[model samples]
Target: MTKDPKVVSFERTPAYLHHRAMLNRRENNTIDALELMRHAVERSPENREYRLDLAELLYEMGCHEQSNKLLLDLLAEDDGPSECYYGLALNQLGMSDVSGAMKSLKLYQKRDPNGPLLGEVARLAAELTLYESMNRPVSRRLYRATRIADRACEAMREDMPEKACRLFEKTLELASEQYEMRALYAMSLCMVGKVGEAKRNADLAAKGFPPSVRALCVCAQVYGILGEDELAFEMIRRIEDEHPYETERRLFIYTLGEMGLDERAADCARLALQETPYDRELLHVRAIAMKRAGADDRAVAGF
Candidate 1:
């Protein structure tokens, strides 16, 4: 039989508050969670994980500098966990401080060669290595902006939009007029459930690159998510009129799938399959659509 959860006792221990903070976070009460996290830190000033939890919460709330300070202070202690360096690396990356980010990542790798996060750190380090190709000097601000934007892309693809959006915010501060980056940042905002902000940012992107097929497709997706299906389908019609390439057409199909218009998604999938008959992504999407529509495994497999 399942046992009852432990009851909170009268003694208000730091660990108890920390446990409550985690529970609040799970319930989506971030404000309360943050307050409780702060209380936990105060009560257990010397506890590494308590302080780390507070710093992580601050990071999620976009307080990068403070988060970095806390993480760095933790690292300065003799018994610092190797994970503190990884947290510092994330903060540095969010701030567009690639040098600092790499330094921390390298330190983390050195300290924990076979650590659980080594694979992820190695991937980021490999991407950082690409910056070495700038044989000639590049503009510092622009270079940092691009590096941060690239890191944001990697973060989002890894399903960590909280980190990606924070980095993109820094990227835009440096290169506010980067149209493509703005569009990508809007997508990241969407991933983070900032729908109204996403629409505004996506609109900014569309205004910059009005006639680009890719921009319009993303605009349609944003509109679709904002409950303006008519506008989205209108954008869809515009893309169809433009007769974009097979690869570009995937964007529209993707929006259709996301909008729950599975029939239209399947139709577009079939049309795309006519060109690249064995395209794995399209095939998988087709199979998924079929499965969502109540198809049996055999029928889905046949797709």
Candidate 2:
């Protein structure tokens, strides 16, 4: 597997960066990918392909509006009728503009009737149509918020605590009424040891938002961080009280395990297994909990 030669001309700078970023993304190193993409953009300001690719990567990375702006700029350029329309349609979809996306998608198909992206375009069109029919405005808002939150979550996973905190803060500020955004902010704050602030945000989320499963889960996390074990258990019970599905039960159990509630976590896992019997992720977490509890035999059985 010989690699492409490094770009000497600045025009190749973006491609070089993009290739490096692709390598990072393949390795699940999203932070490194983002940083490399940033460097690529900086190096090749005039290459429209580079710019478009950067925008596409950002959109995929959960920075929708930022990517939308770049895609829009590309569409506005005086190029021949090209793939820019397809990019624009995707941005429309990202913004949850089903009608607009459909309109642009039709134009893209008409312009490039045999284009390679037809299948993908059609699939997204159908998905957006269903979403628009269900709840247009809410779908749009949720999509935008999810995109922003995904980037924040990726930053957290990459161990860039401060960057994740900033992204969470900005995302929450942008969607002040969004419970999930607030919850993520709280979780990020807790990760960075700002437990007091995390608790305040969690409390605000609990009060301001409608009864959200995510908000409640976040409240559990905050309480656990603050050493309010009883409150944390109570919060976990709030979800159980709702009769969570097996998947949700696993999520709650994992949260408890992550918070170091070994006994409670193990109990939740046991109950969930009676329903699922062999859920791999749940089994894995249960093994860890059992190990923590010094139930070596039971822990080994989980494997």
Backbone collisions counted per model = 0, 0
Cα lDDT tens digits, model 1, 83-172, are 888888887776667888889999999999999999999998888767756532277888889989889999989999999999999999
The models' CA-based lDDT, in order, is 0.81, 0.74
Q: What is the Cα-based TM-score of model 2?
A: 0.52
- Residue runs of model 1 more than 4 Å from their true location after superposition: 1-143, 290-302
Error of 2 at 160 (Å): 1.6
- How far is 207's C-alpha from truth in model 1 (Å)? 2.4
- Model 2 gets an lDDT of 0.74
Off by over 4 Å in 2: 1-143, 294-303
All candidates: TM-score? 0.47, 0.52
